[model samples]
Target: MDEAAGSPAVSRRIAPQRASLRPWLLLMPLLVFLAAFFLVPLAQVAMMSVTEPEFGFGHYASIATDGFYLRVLADTFATALLVATCCLVLGFPLAYAMAAASPNMAAAMMIVVTMSFWTSFLVRTYAWMVLLGRSGPIAALLDWIGLPHGELLFTRFSSTIAMTHILLPYMVVSLYAVLRKIEPSLLRSAASLGASPTSVLRHVVLPLAAPGVVNGLTLVFVLCLGFYVTPILLGSPREQMVAGVIGQQIEEFLNFGEASALAVVLLASTLIVLGLYHRRFGLDKLWG
Candidate 1:
């Protein structure tokens, strides 16, 4: 009986069990960290949304019915859409250039594109304030051209431009990853088959690059919805985004319930955008 208990069959069974548990053991730390820091705080905020001020869903009800909250929600979605579009428009050409360049040149261009990440957000925001001020280089250029550049500092245009600049790197990197993987032979074959440059791009390049475009657009749009600094500093006070309103409610009114409700709404909106993307195209291709 003792020899049978220590037999090779028993060892094999035990080894498989230990091997199967290894991955979960390795992931235990990360799981614990997320549960403690992220899940706990999120659960607290969700609880506060209904429990604060009263044990009811009045804050969410107000958000659904109130004109100011509805308008802010609309504005936030619109602004996110605009920024995502702008990033795509501006980043695609640059990313194409990077993909088409020599290795050294591509690396240099990538460095230029990614340099913005090295700067702190506050510093970049301040730099924009200086550049968009009445006496900045852009205004000076307009002055030289004898064109009026009225109020470049605090407007939707400024906010949009700044957000576009900040988010452009993400779009470019996404496109470049997919574009770099394209086979030159395919493009050559299209051209060899009498396809015009535009036709080749329309038929071959864009389709292959679609995954990257979707990834970039989704990433930038979700990020823009939660943007707090650039819009607050550069945007018009009247045209407040949901994030700005959330901050204002917490800081000024001490309205924890309203702020928590707004935060939950913003998180839900982001998740909905991602879910739609996943439904259309599997999320596994998000990296491309």
Candidate 2:
């Protein structure tokens, strides 16, 4: 009997090793692709950032000493934070409605959101330009309503609005996925236990939905940091993002070293934020 028991224990120990090997085998192609495409190019960019023009940290030094570069970095973080907050404020209720809707209604809402995604990003940005320009329908409507004539395009407000529009769908989808798993009976139970609707939401629902909120905010913020097209088409020179700065360095200035340096900074900042989010909120909960 001891021998039989020990045999099962040994098998259990070996089973995990076999299972691990299977996943690694399955992931081999992805691993090879990441090494070839992502790792190799990243290493090349890092090398270029440091050694492109006379080496010895000049590219990094420019980022530290130049006020213009520092302002660009600040603006990038500011815009990302603003957009993420806006998405959260606007998306949470929408997600709740979708999650609570009938299957048919939810499916219709999903189709509309998916269609928005399928439209070309460039076309979307340009469309906003046409809608918000001085001679556009929105501008004309405001004038007809006796409002002061305003220039909406090529401003920070337009940039924020366009980014919020583009990113709101992502936020809604993330929240909806998590909200769906929350049992409706839980809310009913809370209400039956003398909890007000507001109290149930404040104490139970918010805590349960936090993981999704964090995930969505992190995703939208990171995407906002890298935004280029909307800002380029609808924003002023002062509203230029880090991506715009990098583009100018490459295209107009022809300064590969500076461009590589900016790209590295952007990459490092994104990874740092992701690391902090993971540390604060065990990323396992995202899947859980």
lDDT of 1: 0.93
Q: Poorest 10 consecutive residues of model 2 by lDDT?
A: 279-288
- How do the residues 1-288 of candidate 1 rate in per-residue lDDT, one tens digit apiece? 888777888899899998999999999999999999999999999999999988999999999999999999999999999999999999999999899999999999999999998989889988899999989998999999999768998888888899999999999999999999999899999999999999988999999999899999998999999999999999878888999999999999999999999999999999999899999998777766
Error of 1 at 195 (Å): 1.4
With a 3 Å backbone cut-off (N, CA, C), the pairs that clash in candidate 1 are none
Report residue 6 deviation for candidate 2 (angstroms).
15
Which TM-score value belongs to model 2? Answer: 0.88
Give per-residue CA lDDT, model 2, range 43-77, as digits (tens). 99899999887687898998999999999999999
Off by over 4 Å in 2: 1-26, 193-196, 284-288
lDDT values of the candidates? 0.93, 0.90
- TM-score between model 1 and native: 0.94
